[model samples]
Target: MASIEKLPMLAAGYEKLTAELRALRDERPLIVDAIEEARAHGDLSENAEYHSAKERQGQVEAAIADLEDRVSRAQIIDPTTLSGDKIIFGATVTLLDDDDKPVRYQIVGPYEADAKAGKISYNSPLGRALIGKRVGDEMEVSVPAGERFYAVEKIEFI
Candidate 1:
């Protein structure tokens, strides 16, 4: 049932989230020990360590729950499994701006999108504009700066 509505998440992102969830689960014993030790130290009314441990426990549990849900809902796709001229999810594209400046970007899922790494989320403005476009296609994307024009130079699903 959790797999019915597939969530588009990068394979790497899914692996990272599952690893984090495992680490959080491993911290259960430590959190329990901290709480028990704190409780043994003093009264319920004035216990800083106890309160801190309880808060940390709540945070860890919440993170575990969220990560589990995300990992369960993720639908992983390998970029190499694709072969198309048109831009789509996991497609790396090269573009030439109106000013002749060259730019490259890989359209990826939201969780794995890192602008600094030249990875853009498919839901992003530029990514949306690039979708369904092939080499030699011209398009304009509206960004915070302004509308920018680009000509698709290449598409790679590597």
Candidate 2:
């Protein structure tokens, strides 16, 4: 089997995923009870409860597998430990758009990406453009709507 590539993420993101996986594992007993109850209902051919329970079990199994894979390939990086004056992964970059409006975004891993929360994935267009850039440096990023220019105003590890 091909080796799985490691995923880069901040310590917070890694901890969040770990907690979610733990919670899911804890729900295993409840899922078992659901399956047993469904089976006791009898008539498997027409049993909607049984089918639903089986589907839920499949979903749980899939989630567990996905979480396990991510955990196995995790390359956790603590932002607080990093000291950088330039834009890099896990750095919170403040930018000034063409309109001179300030916007802040944290460059994060794919799984931790939340545009609404100002966290962009490293593979995203804007994140790629910001990489290696320093404060006061202007860069053009290609978005789905087209190219947009941004000036780096500040870079922080937090």
Candidate 3:
């Protein structure tokens, strides 16, 4: 049998996907009804509404399938339940720069990584630099803007 690939993500991220999947499932009947109604209007070849509804149905089905695949293969890991001294997957790390400014980031899977929200993916440059780092360990990271330096100040599971 082929290996069952696992994708790690936080509990909240998994919950979000579940909610999206549920919404997509709920929308299926509405799309079906639309298609039926559109078909009743006239010849399908000339009907724009029918074509649009059919296209929408296809899109919705595709989204549902993708979300289901991701969720089924997910290996959910709740950061709050994890504890470690060194930065690792699901660890929220706090770092201080040369200017004494603090920046916080949580290492997560690529699917759940939102840089704006300070959740960095393990595959990212900064995340790779921070991995396995303990408190007081300093490292320089090369970002798009320039090279930045930071010292690990704290690591928390939450």
Candidate 4:
């Protein structure tokens, strides 16, 4: 029995990966054509085209394997299905740091992590600290810089 760990992902994230996999699969014919053309050029020992084509084939196969592994382990969790007041996966949270400055972030899976977009992975230090917290809850997180305190201002599922 091959057991796969459940990978969490947002619908958009899942769709994006699916599209990438589809594009890779669609490029298979072009890769085959390139290999055939390269082989016709003769002298196998010094053929750059042939070597490049083989390298491309290896890259494509590796990508396919990685994508398959991700898809197999995926456990899609819809944000809309959640009904909770406490912070949990897919929940957008607003926190006030010790300085009284507000920072907003959404807890998502590793696959959907995009710090620039305000999406943090649940496994991250900050995200882990925010989990199970409710509005008005004060918590301290130990980061590389030092220990920082934050108060949960709001929790929303979006």
The model with the greatest lDDT is: 3
The order by descending lDDT is 3, 2, 4, 1
Report the Cα lDDT for residue 48, model 1: 94
Pitting candidate 1 against candidate 2, the one with the higher TM-score is: 2
By TM-score, how accurate is candidate 1?
Answer: 0.88
User: Residue-wise lDDT of candidate 4 within 41-143, one digit each (tens)?
Assistant: 9998899999999899999989988998898778888888887889999898989998999999989988789988999999989999998999989999998
Which predicted model would earn the best TM-score?
2
Task: Give the C-alpha lDDT of model 1.
Answer: 0.89
Per-residue lDDT of model 2, residues 1-158, tens digit only:
99779999888889999998998898888888988998898888899888888888888889989998999899998777787777888999889998999999999999999999999999999998889999989988889989899999999986
CA shift of 126, model 1, Å: 1.6
Evaluate model 4: give its lDDT: 0.90
**Candidate 4 at residue 12, lDDT?**
81
Error of 4 at 46 (Å): 1.5
Q: After superposition, how far is residue 89 of candidate 1 from its true place, in Å?
A: 0.7
Candidate 4 residue spans exceeding 4 A from truth: 142-147
**Collision pairs in model 2:** none
TM-score of each: 0.88, 0.92, 0.90, 0.89
- The order by descending TM-score is 2, 3, 4, 1
